[model samples]
Target: MYSLLFYLALRDAWNLGAIDPTSGTATLLEVTRVLGDMYSKGFRPRRSLMFCSWGAEEYGLVGSIEYVQEYVKVLGARVVSYLNLDVAVSGNYTIRSTASPLLVDAIIEASKMVPSAYDSPEQTVYDKWKKVRWNNVTNEPIIGNGLGSGSDYLGFDQLAGSSNFDASYTFNPADHGNLGSYPLYHTSYEVFSMVKKFVDPEFQAHRALGQFTGVLALILCETPVLPFNVNRYTSALRQTIDSFKTNDSTMFDLLRSATNDFGIAAEEFVARSKSMDVKNPYVIRAYNDQLLQLERAFLNPLGQGGAYSDMK
Candidate 1:
């Protein structure tokens, strides 16, 4: 199963403007609109797709976290991926995403299929992502690998152990003195008119985000081999392990050896997937189940730092 989560709550401060469209309302509209369009076009998914509108997100992720806690086992066994859209269109400078390592390839593929919000006809979201934001070491479009404690995706990522992601069409931070978020964030000025007048007047950014996210969901639902790149996990692990500046050589060697063994296993898994008999439903289910549960294996059910919810 694939799930799409959009929050329906806003900050607590009272303001003159009753409209709090940018943070949550716009995201909900884009997600529902895409789902409606998909239905109208008569596109039926091979796998299950869920549309979830979470409440009280601004009140410490109350809605989504509780839901995951209630159904962790069921979700862990069944859910393949979770896509969260909290602020879909804050700005249109470029598309930004933070995702699990397993989903990097799918996100890139979906971005390539969607056109840029304000670029030339031939330019795609992938092109903008590469040109505007990328990794210096690899010279490729950059994506956040860690799903930090912030949106609705946290529960799905850490607790349920479902591969998950959050994305937005964002403004360039340099243009706003490198502020954490847009200037009107959580303010009275975050109304529909604000989005129309300044952020995305033509709503092209919103449309682009909708199409990108929808295409990603479709890829997950329709693909037979489960478009996951397990090899990405190897790279992520190595990079993370390298970040530690510990002087304990013994511990470091143990960690490196473990990562190497995991890399070998990942390669073998990919090779097996390629040679699998796709005609057999049992075989397909077995292969796909491994891919789905790979992330769950990293979870510690007892939780991290005495907090059960921080299992991942």
Candidate 2:
């Protein structure tokens, strides 16, 4: 179902002449985890698993968008979630877990299991992630920010309206704050040297990234009650909208009222969903399907143009 015509973008075909930016570390780690999961866990998932290697991500998410277009119906019906693994070792941030409401808890839990990029084995990835997040954004470690259109994640989220997210161990001063990114991006200069020497000198970040990815993926597939936080989403939305009450009191007041009502409903929904019977496969399927369709409610039916759309 892939669109061959869209697969080979002209720039990628000509400029892509060296090794991957990850230097094979992310791929190798993924392989190791997959083999381990199969052997140790023995395919205990309530649903089938999938691993995707998208080809034309840089070309406006061509590969993933086409794949989702191909499998939209089946994916919507059966897929529990989508976790993206791109730019595995971006910088050296311990972990930056940003996702839809349903995935925030799973991401945080997985982070607690992996080693921190900081010192001490006792300090888990979640500790570092929360510290970084707090230093940058809020007082507490909140599951903040919905995924926006940028990479392959766009396909699963914007196009397919699937519960999705992307994680990476990166928070370079250059990319966000006072520093600037490596000028070699999208060029031959964007080689292993930059990633190893500047981005992730120790390469432990790559392993941490892999562990986080594997854990979150397994949780989605195996957990009887999907690790989504409807209340968190509602709460965050309320907090965010509350910031601009002065702009237009009428509309802002209306929004406040709506989100507050939604928050109450979300709390009840979370309790009900979590209380489901774990032993009943039929109940799990029904509950999982509800989680899958939840994302589609946010899709703007007219959101069809540009890299930065209104959908996400």
Candidate 3:
């Protein structure tokens, strides 16, 4: 249940012009406008499109968690991914994301398609994102591969066992003393004036975000072969395994071997996906199902350490 005091506080804030647009309103505007624009243009997606707005998200993601818990079986089996946009435009600096490794390629592709809000017309979101955080080894923008307990994507990621994506066009943390979020987050000072004057003065960031999100959604819905990077998961797993500081050499070696084998299998899977018959509806459905259910295969039905909420 939502806290009474919190509701009163929010109402008081709203009366004083403290609109919590970043929390969800901005995203709602973006997603809705994109869908409306698509409809106006007579574009129809091959797959279904669903828009979700959950209540009490600030109250520990209460709404989304309950919904996922109720539909976990169906979502786990049929849902391809969850794209979250909470705090859509807290800053005008650059895009930040925490997503399942499977979606890294699709996200990058979408970024490349959307022009950056702050840069020259030729510069794209991918350019700005790569400039902000580059991986020296891979020469690519460093997108996070893990999700923390923060937004609505948590339920879809852990409970529904679906690949999920959460993103924001955020401010530079270096300028804000490396705070976890923007300065006026959930504060009375988070008014429309503040966003207009300081955060996104021209509203270009909002438009860019809408385009990027829309393109990503289209990629997920229209691609004949699911644009999942299965091989990327192998590297993610290897990195996670290597990050452990345990002195257990034997255990580490075993983990490395397993990761290596997983990489080989992932390579095979990618090859098969590339060579599959996309014209046959049954073949396409089965191939897509394999991609969709790969993340679910990692879930432990009983949960992590016997804690049901921690399953992933």
Candidate 4:
């Protein structure tokens, strides 16, 4: 999936003659091609698979938002997990995975099965020098911030209530700078050879990513236990309510009431979840159904108004 997205983004960028800073049309086209290929290959079974190549992602994930609004019910019923990989290939070996605790544990366990890959000693020396220079000038740590819809993961996460993960590696700070670590990014130079050399030398990082993703897919396909953590959901709700309270007290009250109700529901779910036997099909179905409903209860109908409004 990462490779397909990468190729599509790159190809679209090339066809456009230059990057469309506003709409990212070229990027979206590439994504569409990838989805089309997957469909042609019969990758989706009886299950409903959504292949989204969101447009105007650079303008803040508009394409994805529109999609979610149009198909909330279908997404709610089937989207057990949403995995996002954006800018998957980079010059570093650091793998970062972001998700809820249940999903995070699954990713960690899967990543461990893949061997660690690192930059060469010479590359490390250059990275150290660049980091020092940036810190000396900005007085800020050079950390790659968590994922936002600089890619397509935003709508799925914030709107659909789907369990999601975004994974990437950090290598050269140069990649993020105006200088040309990724010289071809938004330019004509983002060709296959350039990616092979500067972006993912030795391909070990790419291989590790494949292994990690494959393991994750296998787990999602096979696991009888639908890993949902109510404690985390409650904490997140509290934080969201606190953040929004300064704007409207009525909204705050509504959120608080909802939070309390959700807490009660969560407790019920936890009890039921803990008691379920992994080997029982009926127990698994019941647990998964409840988990799905618990997520749906938090949906705000007037918020995003997508098919998966339960997520909002």
Q: Where does candidate 1 stray beyond 4 Å?
A: 1-24, 246-251, 304-312
Give the per-residue lDDT of model 2 (tens digit) for 228-311. 777767866876786664655687777788888887877787788768887997887677666666677677665557643543
In angstroms, the error of model 4 at 47 is 7.3
lDDT of 2: 0.62
lDDT of 1 by residue, 23-130 (tens): 445555666777778889997777877777676677788888888888877887888888877766778899889888999999989999999999998999988877
Query: What's the true lDDT of residue 297 in model 3?
Result: 83
At residue 26, candidate 4 shows an lDDT of 30
lDDT of candidates 1 onward, in order? 0.78, 0.62, 0.74, 0.52
lDDT of 3 by residue, 199-295 (tens): 8899887788777877888888778777889998998998788788877767788779988998999999888877878788889888777877788
Pairs clashing within candidate 1: none
What C-alpha lDDT does candidate 3 achieve relative to the native structure? 0.74
Task: Point out the higher-scoring one by TM-score: 1 or 4.
Answer: 1
Candidate with the greatest lDDT versus the true structure: 1
Give every collision pair in model 2: 102-228, 174-179, 174-180
For candidate 3, the per-residue lDDT at 26 reads 58
Candidate order by decreasing lDDT: 1, 3, 2, 4
> CA shift at 268, candidate 3, in angstroms?
1.2
